[model samples]
Each structure stands twice: as structure tokens, then as C-alpha cells.
Target: MHRLSRALLRALPRAPLLRQPPGPGRLLPAALRPGSRGGLSTRPRREPPAAPQRPAAQGPGGEEEQFVFPEYVAEPGPAPAREPPAAPGRPERRPREKRQHRVTGRPDPSVPPSGVSCSGCGAELHCRDPAVPGYLPSEKYRSLMGGQPGGSEGQGALGRVVCQRCWLLVHHQQALHMQVSREQYRNLVSAALRSPPRHGRRPLVLYMVDMLDLPDSVLQDLPQLVGAGSNILVVGNKVDLLPGDSPDYLKRFRKQLLRSCAHVGILPAAQGTGGQVARTGSQNLVDVHLISAKTGYGVEELISKLQRSWKCNGDVYLVGATNSGKSTLFNTLLQSDYCKSKASEVISRATISPWPGTTLNLLKFPIINPTSDRLFRRQERLKAEAEKTEEQLSDDEQKYLKCLKKQGYLIGRVGRTFQQQKSKAVIEFDPDELSFSMEEEPVFSSNKPKERVEFTYNELKDARWFFDTPGIVKENCVLNLLTEKEVKLVLPTHAIVPRTFVLKPGMVLFLGALGRIDYLQGAKSSWFSVVASNLLPVHVTTLEKADSIYQKHAGKTLLKVPMGGEERMKEFPPLIPQEITLEGIGTLEAVADIKLSSAGWVAITAHLEDKLQLRAYTPEGTTLIIRKPPLLPHIVDIKGNRIRGSASYRTKKPPPLVENLKANGTNKQIKRVSKI
Candidate 1:
């Protein structure tokens, strides 16, 4: 059987192996058929037949042309080379086509560079849009930039120019409506507070709070914003607004401010021993001071303290909420001994106004280095001036002092040192400079002429600066909701004259259309002293007519503020009531103060045995604080005798300058001391 199988295999012709039978139209060699032996054969393989081409077509010129499809034709080219494998421990590189487009660090070219900004508000100077902040007329801007003499070799000339908005605010006492969001204001302050590593030391934060607006002016997150260990000096501004010069009352007021700070978590709460608590609090809170930034009452003392304690250790930052007088204080310091003599001559003053967000940038001046020689000279100068009587002062000094006295009884006059006075004449005058005298009192029309100056680049380099940061907006403040005209009437520009009234149970008191208070339940009639802006009118009526009176008189001439009439009333927020209960301490002393947003506060005085139930109303989204052991507990004494045949009392006027000096027992005596 094996011989027969071998003979059959040999007999088979040399044929190739076939996997399947051929179809009818296709043919295969007989040796390669499906029934043939499954053995390898030595025969060359044949190529498949090519597809047939279509017939040629006739062209317009009667020439023959063949149609060709590009997709079907294979291009004659070499294959692409593969990339080499990456080495061990190295990342594989991506192809150039797969890589993403790279971005650059250059600033946008579309935004025009600002070579100049408003010296008062620090807004970029532009003549493109008037509705925006920092807008200036085209002609005025061109004149300031190109026509001004003594160009200072570069952009330094721009620092001397103020925007149109600030110009109107300073000259005509008109405020422009510029709204700043709370987050943006906070960002500006935070940027000022953050010290770079090269600075070596943290800045001294001069945290200013408004005396009239208590807890509301105090920023709650101050400790968190500036580190917990930061050095803070709590400064109480606008003390002149209060009607008192007594040292004891001022001391009590300072304590009240410290308590408010503690309540807001800016300082540790007083506990255990009083002395120990104070010592512990002093670690973060270096000190607390009360000053009137407007009248310069305690600014000199504050400067002396700053020079002694801080002593040019680092930059000093002024931080506070809006309308806390940060800009006013900055302007006062710019012309004082706290600033370097050379820098003071060059730096322009910041804009001072009742409107919030007046300062929008970090306005700064070089801090004077407190060397031993400088301190000795300062002390000697102060001693000589203190010994001299009012007769010894210059005519200018006397006139300035006289004007300051009208603003506040306890006032300090800013004076220059011998060196500064001698150097002042050397400053070159620019013909095109806009000159205006600083207004002694915001309420008065008179102004003393003074030339403004600008700082050069060489003057500001590598110097420790005293920075004035933008004021943060208070969340619960009513000023945020008011118009510019309404704000002027609400915020005080001069000393506040206490207006007192006798209100029995079921009577109501209205502070313009902004605030309302009802004496709902009380045993006896109470004395309610309204410590508010003199411009805001006070009206008293029965509780039953309170709603009707507001409905009829709000936004009208009777209400005074929100002067647009019925149209303004439509946009104004409605009053919301907050019920409060208090126990009276005595008729002579106020038990508590009901703060109605920023409009003003009312000090409630009633019999010791009386239990008072009150309903305080403020605009919606506004805060109403009832403070115990009121800031001015004995404020009722500041008023005059009660008016005859009426529930109102005559407001007391500020005492004469001579009487105030004598009452305070000043060491220096004036020969020409007389009442104005």
C-alpha cells in the first residue's frame, strides 16, 4: 500500500497546492486543482489581470482626452521614516503638528498705556469717556500734558494734575457720583497691606474708625485680613463732630472704642484682670488714639507717638472703611512734620470730600526718618512755639488759628520747621499749575491760596513710604444707597450741634426720611438727643401719624434730602422696623444709643425706674445698633435750656476759643483772649 501511494504522488504533475475549487469563469492549472495531491510544486506565481480603462471623450477643439480619477492613482514617493524610541528615564517628545500654541507674557497692546493719572483719586487719565472715572476734557488734558511749563523731564508733570471730578469737588464743594463695589475696595486695601519679602518688616496699620459711626466703622475681619500678629494702631477720626473738649469724656470715649474693637474680634476680649487684658491686647494692638482729622485736634500728638514707637521701622499704612476720614487725614499728614521735609514739598494733597471712595489708589509720601538730631530740633521748635502767646504768632498763623477755632475748640495748627520754611522758597513755580488754597473748614466759602506740586521719579525711589489705602465699603451702611446730593446732607462737614427733644410715650421722632423712632412703652417722658448732621431736619409727631407723615412728606422739601421729589421716593428703600427693649439708668445719664445706619444716633435718657420698649426703623438692608453705656453717656448736658411752649430744646453753640482754652487749663496764656 505505501509503494502504491508513492507511485501515485510521483505520477501527479508538478502542481501548486489549492485551498478551494475554482469558479466557473476562472480557471486553474490541472495540477493545482482541488482534487490534485496536496504537495508543494515548483511553479512561478502569476499576477492578477489589470482593470480595463474607459473610452476617450471628444473635447471642444475636437481633440481626444482620457478621464483620470486622482483618488485611485497611487503616488510615487518614499514612505515616511518612523521616530526613534525614547531613551530610558526620558519623556517622549510630541510631533510639531500635535503641539499646542504657546502663550507669551507680554501685556495687551490694545490697551493704551497710562502715563498720567489723577493726583487726587489715582484714576488713569483719559479724555475718551466722560461718564467713567478719571475723565477729563480733551483740551484740558492736552493743556495739562503738553502746555504745562517745567515738564520735569518725563511723566512727573502728570502727577500735579487733578481730574475734572476732583476739581469740582475741591473748588465748588460738589461731589461726583462714583460707585465702587465692596470687593474692589477690599482688594485695593489688601494689596496695600501685603508687604513684599524685601521690605523686611510688616507695615504699621493705622486702622481708622469713625467716632460718630461706631461699630459699623470698625471692620470685623481686620485681624484676619492683616495677619493676627500685625501691629495695629486704632485711630478714632471725626472727634470734632462730638460736642465736647473734656479730657475725662475723651478718655471714656477711647475706652468705648476699644470695647467696640474687641466686640468686632479685632482685639481679644477683656477678661480676668483689667491690666493683664490690656497688656495682652497690646501685643497686636500697639495703641489706640482719638483725633479729629478735619480740625487737626490730636494729629500732632499722634505724629509724635508714631515717630517714637515706629521710628521709621517700616512703611505705615492708613486703612479704614469709607467716610472714615482716611483721605482727610492723609491730606493733613502730607503737610505736617510726619512727612519728610523734601518729599512734603513735592507731594500733592489727596482730595478731601464727604463722598465715599474719594481715594482710589495708594497715595503715599516718604516717611521722615526719626533721627536723634531731627527729634531734638522738633522738640526745641515745639517748646519755643508753646511758650509764645497768641500775640507772638505770625498774621497768617493767627488767621488760620482763628478759623480752626470755629471748627473745633480743641484744635491743633500745622506748622513748618525752620528748615522747611527756608527750603520752601527754593521750589520753582510752574506757570500752568492749577493753584487753589486749602479750605480751612469744609462748610465755609473762603479758601487760602496755595500752589500744588508734583514728585519726580528720583524723589520716590528706595524710600520708606506712608501709604493711604482706599477705604473699604461698609456692607450695612445707608450711605451706599443714597444719591450724591443726599449724602452731602447726611454726612456732617462741621461740628455737630446736639438737637434735643422731649418725647412722651406714643410719640415718634423722624430724622428726615432716613430714620424713625417710636417711644412705644415708657413710664415717663424721655429726653432724646439727636446727634446728627445739622443739615438734616428733625421732626416730631404722634405714633399714629408716623406712617402717613412719611408717605406725604418723604423726598419733598419738608424731608430736604433725596430732593428729586416723588420720583426719588419711588427708588428709595422702604423703612423696616426693629423692636428693642432697654432699662433706663437715670434721667441725667443716657442708658443706651440707637444708631440709625449712618444718618445719626439718638441717645435715650429716662428715669432709672422706667422700663423702655422702643421700635427703631431704618431703610431696608441697613443696620440699627443699640449700644449700651452710650458713647456719650452724658450728652444731654451739651444742649441749651428747653424751648417754651414746645417739646423741642434750643441747641447749644460751641463756646468761644478763649473760654475753651481757659476751661482746659492750657499752660500758655493769650494776651488778646476774647470771645468771637
Candidate 2:
């Protein structure tokens, strides 16, 4: 039965599966063949036509008698040589222009849209590559540009902005610091100084200063930048970082700023309006207003002042140091002023980072003024309000009063400083226009001192534009010595929780790796209040083992707050240590202080100064300033007590931020504080 079944299956081969079809032979037409239409059988493959041969011709230098296909064939190329790989060590630049859109086949229902550009940085935006700056998902880009998410228009909005690089740095807490060479800085500064006013109208300057980082070089160099005649509004920012609000402290702050400026010969320019002025020194060109950009404390007043300045002058320049909070102040002002500020946030017009030089190129923001009808009503309201009594003013009217009051205090302080020093007569200005009013002092040779602006403003139609320039980065600031991570840890993010350390003669203290202080002499067991960031990592050791401890634990054990783990700790150079011995009879009995440049300072209060040695250390290139302790009030002593007469003021936590500084020069100058 099995044999019969196998034979039957073999015979039935055709029944199980069809046999392979035979290859086609020369076949008749479909009409002539069976079961076919009027068509020929399968079409035959055809070979490519060969190039026609030409008769041999006599040639001058031709080697081949018969011209066969040429050995070397050349055709026009599509892309340039750099189409794929860029030169090594240089970053590949994206093309400014975009490619054409791609259309699908057949129905062509799905077509790739044209490339979009980032409104913020001007880089072409793309949804494909996630690692690059302009990469954004099609849906997110649309949403950011004000379109609904998942809309059919997956193509991004023309007004949408913010490249991926800025997005990450702004929102993701990147430790990126933007550094430019001193030459570049100088060029940018000069351009800003020489920026021509729009419509040939007067240009005003918003001189932003970091109050906490007072006594800076830029403050002294203002006269050189804007000339002695530019209208200057001294915007004192980061006031919230201060520990106290005592009236006396405010006065001291102003004087310190004036003194610093005076030392550098930055006397204000003579005023435009000749008025009966007091013999205030050449400080009238400056109008100081203290405010906290982070907390929006004085932003409202600043905005009002800015608006008034705009109406008075067509051009306004916002200038400051990299870490002086210019970017923060800019963002805050826009958010409060512009209708499309949300769009600005998406683009992060100017990133607010702890790192200095975050704002590199010049940025322009437009101011949209109200219509004439609305402007007239607003003007009437303002004029009427000016006539109203202070008691009748509403909350909104009083909101900016605090900052407004500061302007007067600053003026009074400057006057007092001039009264004491008998320096150049201080010039006073109109508080509203910031124009100097110096009728007493002769106008320094009357030809406008060659600095008077040539622009004239006949009619004010709401100044439409404001310019922002990159902040200057000073070289000697201790903030420049720290790593970005170290900066976040060392700069106060909240109210500074003053850390007190008890020390005998042989004790040493380290302010991270940036600064080190050693008490070589312990006179009367005096108390020193170490006021610094709460996050600062401090290690106390005996003076005998201080050097070795630092050598072994430069960034590892004793100084370890960067949070980059052990690997980062290895990058810091050996701390540059310098010791100053106070052996004079005065050194024994008088109290002396040591400043860590701009970071913080240490005061050695001893009845017996007996050979007190202050061994200061900094990063290799950083400058160390050991000056008289800052004349700040409200200091606490070791017994957990505040000093008499000056009560300590506890301010609210500061906005999370870090002071940024960059080195502009390599020259090192060491200043010592002499005992008073």
C-alpha cells in the first residue's frame, strides 16, 4: 500500500504543486496566440545604446587614433567640497539660506515644509536633528509660535523663536559661560558708545551697576565710555542680595560708589539746562536708583523712568557688567512691558544665567507705545496725579515710590561726599530727563566740550527701540577664579546664612578654593564673622598643617563644593598662596581686615595684633585685594550678637542667582589694607 501511495503521489505531482513554467520563446502576437489579448508576449530586455563611433581624424596632439569612450570622464558637480565633512577643530557652520521643500509621490498628500528659522538666534530651525541648536519637534515649534499643538500646519511659525542652545542654557541650568576677548569687548563697547541715534534724536544711557559688586572698574570708566556729556541713569541692581536696609547703609553704599568712581576720575558731565545749582561736585550727570532685578522690587519704577527717558530721547542703551544682572533686568522689564513677552520668553531674548557674558551680541527690543488717544488720556492722568497729595495716591501710585525715594538719597549722598572732599563741583541733573544741570560751573570751553550730541528731538512719538549690549567682564573679580559649578555654590542664592567660626591663633579657613585666610596671630581670641554664601564649603585646620592640607586637599577634602565629583576637583591648579606679616606695633594692637577681592573679606579684630600673618590664596591668575573691611553695618559678633546702634536687618531670600565675572586683563595689582 505504501509503494502504491508513493507511485500515485509521484504520478500526481502536477496535482500537489504546479511545475515550474518554461522560459518564454519567440511568441506570436496576443491576437494570434490562445487565451491572449491583442498584445505581444513579454517585452524583451534591451541593452543600452553604445556611443556612435567617429571616423579617425588627424589631430595635433591626440594620442588615440580612434576616439573610444574617454578614460577620464568629468561632469558638473552638485555640492562644494565641504558638503560633508568640515575642517577639523573648527565648528561646522549652518547655511544661512534654506533648501527647497520636498513633495511626496502620486497624490503628494505629505510634503515636507520649508526650513524654519529661529527668531532668537536666526539659525534655521529643523525638526530632524535633536542635538543641534535649531532642532525642535514640528508640533512644539507650532505650539510655541501660538498655534495649537498637533495642528495640521506642522510647519513652525515665522515669529516662533529660541534655538535649542539658548533653550537648554536658559531653562536647563547649563554651566555655559560666554567669554569674549578683551579686544572684542572693547570693540563692542566702542560701538555702543558710538551708536548713532535713530531719526537724529538724542540717545540716552541706562548705566546698570551691580550694587553688591560695588567699587568696580567699569563704574570708574564710564566717563571714557559715554563721554562726560551723555545722559546717564545709574541703575543699581542686585540690591536684594544685600543683608540689610538701614538708611545709613544706603548712604554708605552711595558714597562707596561715588568714591570708587571719583578715584578713577569719572566725574559726571555738565548739565544741558543751565540752572541755579549748588556747588555739588561733578556728580550731577548721574541719577542712581537701587532695585533688585530678580525680585522685581524696583523694576516698575525703572520701567516708568525708561518710558520717560524714551519720550525725552529716541535712543536708550542698557549697559552693565556680565554678572551685573543686565540680562535679568532686561528680561524682567520686557515681561512687564511688552505684549509679546511670552514669545520673548520662548526665545529667551537674553538668557539669564549665573555665567558671565551670557549676552554676547547686541539685542534690540521694540517698545510699542499706546495710540494717540490713549497716550493723551495717560498724559492727563499722570499730570493730574502729579498735582494730587501723597495721602490720596493709590497703591499703584505708591508702588514705585520706594525706588523713586532712592534717587534722592543717592543725590544727597553725592552732595555730602563732595562737601567733604572739596573735589570738582558735582553737577546735578533733572531727575526726569537725567540731563545734567550745571549753571554754576563754566561749560568746560563752551563748544559742548566736543562731546555734545548733534541729534535734535522736535516731536516725541514714543521711542520705538532700545539697544542692549554685552556687559563688560572685569579681570580681577574672584568670581572669575571659580568654576561655574563653584560659582553657584559660592554665590548666594538665598538669604546669606552667616556662618560663624571660632578661631584661636593657629586656625586657618578656606572659602572654597578661591580664597584662604590664616590667623597666624591669635590676639585676645577675637571674633571674626565670616559672611559668605551658605553653600560655601569650609574646612577649618590648624595653621601648622594648613599648607600641607591645602596641597593634599586642594579641591578634594578641604575645598570640595563644586559638586563635579573627584574628577573636577583635579582640574584646579595648586592654590597660589601669599602671606603678609603684620609685625609693627600697630599690627599688634589695631584691628585689620583682608578682602578676597570681590568674593568676601575677613576682619582680624585683636587687642594684640602680635605678628598676625594673613596667608591669602587664590586661583593662579586671580587678584587678591586685602583692603579695609567694607564699611557695611549690621554685623554680628561671635557671641551670637548684633553690634550696638546698628541693628541687623533680615531680608527675604534672594532670587536664585550667581554673581558672574570674567577676567579682562592679565595685570595683577595687590592692595593691602593699612591699619587705621
Candidate 3:
């Protein structure tokens, strides 16, 4: 019966098992309820009369053999409530900040005891004296007053302070700020140009051309300054007023300007009665392009080219005349939809402005290789050479050696040792390293008698490194009367005495207004010839801006400017056909349809037979080479997919975009879709 009782209690309800306590309820029948699975009793039932249990025997190891585990009694628990899903835009929770009191400086036993003078009074005392102004009562007191992490010794490294009254008198005078004069600013520019550092890569010069009157004063010597093998992109400002649809317009203008330039001994080839002597169908060279910075039309192309050049570690400089939008271009390049800024930090008293004559200053910040201390040191030395006399001991050089300085780069001084104590001395130094043959003679023609001045580091280096100086100095004597302010105003005008000046070489990049050729009333006096004759570059591109300027002016009685045998007459219907072929490195894909003003039959088609090529021929069977494409490396996508050959071809007009249609003619029509 007792065994039966134990087995029966095992099946009793769990909730009431402990409460039953071997009472009459333990024997109840309904203790097992349906669907009460986990709710069953966990407690063992107690028998009214039970036999005592025996302990298990120990094993050979003398350890207890067996044990019975205690049963768990379930207690009543609170029911859990359902929670709703979180909102989509809610931010994740973050940990809180911790605030703690930090300990100040501790005493270091290694440091030696030293005495300090007090700024408050003339008293000098040991570190331990409390009465003296310089005294610190103890290490603890010193640490508290020093307010340094490492206590008294660390504070002492910062140097001793003066007595309060003395300190106030010493610092009472307000610090005066002096801005760099225009002349000094120009000198600074001369310094930078004289010592432009090698960036380990070619630099990119954004050659900006004034769409209207490109002054002979600005960017007139760009070809020399930018150096050979440098990427100089020409961008024409102010194009919003011109027609953008005509593609051939720019080409015709280039041909006309090239012809005009040839007359003045500026352009490379002379134009005959016919257009540029057809090269017997040889390959056409890469050409310059037009873009209006004021209108933001071709800026995208310029940015793309700049980015590509920068990828190869090229440095880009904004070069242009005053008010030609150099600063505007910088702002435009920096501005985005997300963040807008005035970007006025570019300005400093010695800063080079976009204004003509003032654009000479160039600032270089270490963006790529910051670890190159030696590189910067070499560059600084070069700059110092531009400011100091030839063979003279510069400050940095003086730190190591003692040597008599020559005027400029030569070995000579102004006055005699006794009779003529002070006289004018001029030193001409070659600032540029790349151009070995440049004339470094410091010519002195003094507006006033020249004077000698000792060269200092911070005073000259700071200006030399930051300002723009683009003018040529004709003289060498340093004028005593001209203050820094007076120099600043005259530097831009190229009117300063050249004798003691940091002379800058003139550079220029000309843009031939190809599309505007026909519209030009005085093609002979165009700005292109002015620049070409002066700051001539090895390479030039005539950016065709119009479709057919000559064709439109053809048969009209326009004034003719004869360039060699080529006449800049009214537009003419050329007997030659309009044919263009573009060849480059990779495959050429698509081309636009050609539009000829003369209206002659033409055959135009594109081919990918060997790489990508575009071929065009006239009805008379004349072929023209547009350009040769650049070779590119094997291209691929992020997903291991291949990227097809890319080429953008433009003709008389841009190509129109086409839409795809379904095989079934049941696709919705454009007019029908508009209603929805």
C-alpha cells in the first residue's frame, strides 16, 4: 500500500502537491486534470506510514556511491506583457558619459633644484621659499599652483614667470598687426616661383582664359612656368551668352584664329587661301576646349580631367587674371548640395588674389607625403636663395658656416671698406631650377639710390611662400624710400624697381575662339594673337566653338585681314568636304551625325574592327582625322564583370537619347502616359 501511495502521489497536480502535505487531499482523484501538462506537481507525496531508506555502499576508492537530487518547488510568477515593434526612424541608444575627478601633478625625484626670478618683484629665491615671489612652499604647493599633470618639475620646464607688476607692464602694449604690402606680396610670389618644389609628380595648371579681353598682363608666361610635359588645360570663361547647340562652330573659329595667329609669327602653321593646308589626311591633333565658369557648363569636364590628373598625384594651381573667376572656380569646385561655404580662409594679408597681377602667389600645403621633412628643407633652401645674395651666408647656412655674401648670386659688395662706407648693391639670382639658361643678371636702374639690407628668415620666408608675384623686375637696386605698403601697390603694375626684386617670369595660355571667328569684326586684333606672340607654348589647341562661322559669313562683304596668303574674309562655302575621324587608345564606340553648312553628300559610319574607330568621308571622297584616342588599361567592374569600351563623339550637334520599346506594339504611348 505504501509503494502504491508513493506512485500515486507522483501523478498528483504540482500546484497543490506542497499544499497537500500528506493530507486527505493527496488521495483525491481529480488531482490529474486534462491539459494541465506542465502544471503537474513536482513535489513527492509523503506516506502516512513509511519505511526508512538505506544509504548506498562506498566504492573501492572510499567515496560515497549514490545520492538523491532535491526536487524543485514551482512558485507563482508574474505574467509577461506583449511589446510593440520599434518605429523605423528611431535612433539606437548609446552609453552615457562618465565624469571623474583627475589627480594633478606628482613630484619627480629625478629633476634638479633650481631658483627662479619673480615677475612680481626683483626677488630671486630657492624653490622652497614661500615669502619670495619666485618661491614654491613645497612640492605639493608647487604642483597645485603649476596646474600641470607632472607636478613642479613639468611646470618649471615651461619656464619661470615674472612678478605680477612686471608682467603687466611687459605685456601691456597691444600687439600691432601689419599686413604685407603689395610689393612684399609680389616678392613672396617671386620666392615661391623661384623655388617651386618637385611634388614627385607633374603639376596640373588650370589655364583660365578671359572670354572677352584677355589682358596682356595676365598668365602671359604660363608655358614657361608650367614646364614641358605638364598638363595645362585651357578653359574659356563666359560662354553662357554663346550658342551651345552648334558643334562645328568652334572648329571653324579655331581654323580662322590659327590663320590670323600665323600672320603675327605666333601660331605654328600659316593658313593658305584654303583652310589650314590639309595634312594629306594625316591624324588630327588633340584640341583645346571651351567652358564658361560663370555659367557652369563645361565645368564638369574640367573637374573630371582635374580628378584624373590628381589621381596620378598631380598638383593643380588656379591661374588667371583679376576678376576672371579664379576664386569663383575654387568656390564652385568646393561647394556641394550638402555643405555650402564662402571659403574665405584662403585670404591673408600676403594672400594672392584672383585679380590680374595679384595671381602670382601660390600656397602649398602638405597633403600627400607629410613625413618628408628633408623634401621641405630642400625647397626652403631654394626659396632662400631667391631672396639672398649669391654665395651669401643665409641664416640656415650661417648656423653651420661663415662666409662673405655676394650681391645676389655673384661675389661682390656695394661700397669700399673705408672711403665709400654705404653704397647701393644689387644681386640677381635665378629662382627657377628647371630653366638652366635663364638670365640671372640683377640689373639695377634705381628710381632712388639702392641700399643694402640684411636678410632674415621668418620676415622674408613667410611672404615668399604665400604671396603671388607675376611681374618682371627690370632693375636690381633695393630702393630705400619704398615702404612695404608702397611696394604692394606697385607690384601688380610691374612698376617696381627690379634691381632688388624677386622677379617672376611671365606665362600665358591663349584660347582661339573658333566659333566666334565669323562674328569677329577685327579678327586681326584678336586676343589670341596677343598672347601667342608673348607667352608662347609648345602646344596649342583651337577650341571650335561654332558649327560653321565661315560658312555663315560666306558671300557676305566682310573686311578681309590677310594673314600670309590666307584672307580673313567673310564666311565662304569651302569646296572641301567635312570629314572627321577620331582614333584613340581603346575601342571607339559611337559618333554623332555630321552637319555640313555647305550641304554636300557625306558618308559617316563607326567601326570597332581594330579597337574603336570612327571614319567619315565626303561625297567627293575627302577624309579628315578628328583625333587619336588614348590607350587605357584593361577595365573591369566590381562584380568581376568587364566594362565595355568607352568613347564620346560629338559632331555638329550632340546626339539625342533613344528609348526602348517592347516587341509587342502594345506599349503605352508617350501622349497616353502623360494623362496618368
Most accurate candidate by lDDT: 1
Q: List the candidates' TM-scores in order.
A: 0.73, 0.56, 0.25
Per-residue alpha-carbon lDDT of candidate 2 for residues 1-676, written as tens digits (9 for 90 to 100)? 5565566556543332324432343333333345455433553222334554533333322211111111111122444323345689989888767443331212111324235545443345555444433555655554554554334344434445665555656666554332347568657766776777676665677778776556663454666767544666777766555544243455556666656655665545444556644323433345667666765555544555665554556666788776788776666655654222222333445666676666665665655453455445545544453344434556764554434332211110000000112246556554555444553332332323322121125322443566677777777676776666667766664444444444556667777666788767645344444556555555556677777766666556446654454576576545577887653233222244455655665545444435566677766666665544354433333223332222111212212211111112331110000000
Clashes of each: 1, 12, 62
**What lDDT, from 0 to 1, does candidate 2 have?**
0.51
Residue 535's lDDT within candidate 1 is 75
lDDT of each: 0.72, 0.51, 0.29
Tell me the lDDT of model 1 at 278: 42
Candidate with more favorable, higher TM-score: 2 or 3 = 2
Write down the TM-score for model 2. 0.56
Q: Judging by TM-score, tell me the better candidate of 1 and 3.
A: 1
Error of 3 at 387 (Å): 56
Each candidate: RMSD to true structure?
35.8, 29.1, 35.8
* Model 1 C-alpha lDDT per residue in residues 1-676, reported as the tens digit of each score: 5565677678665444557764543446545544446544433333344544533333233211211212112222543334456899999987656432232122222333245767798777666655566766666555555654234532454667787778878876666665557787787777667757225767788999998898888878776666655678899988766776243667777888989888766664345565564435432677789887877767767888898975435788898988899988998888888887766567778888887888877888887777788888878876676566666678987797787766664565555562454434455555535444453322433455465554567756656788888888888789988877789889987667787877788888888889989999998989999888877877777777778888988998666766788898899899999998988888789989999999999999989979999999999999999988788888888776764445666677555332112223453322122110
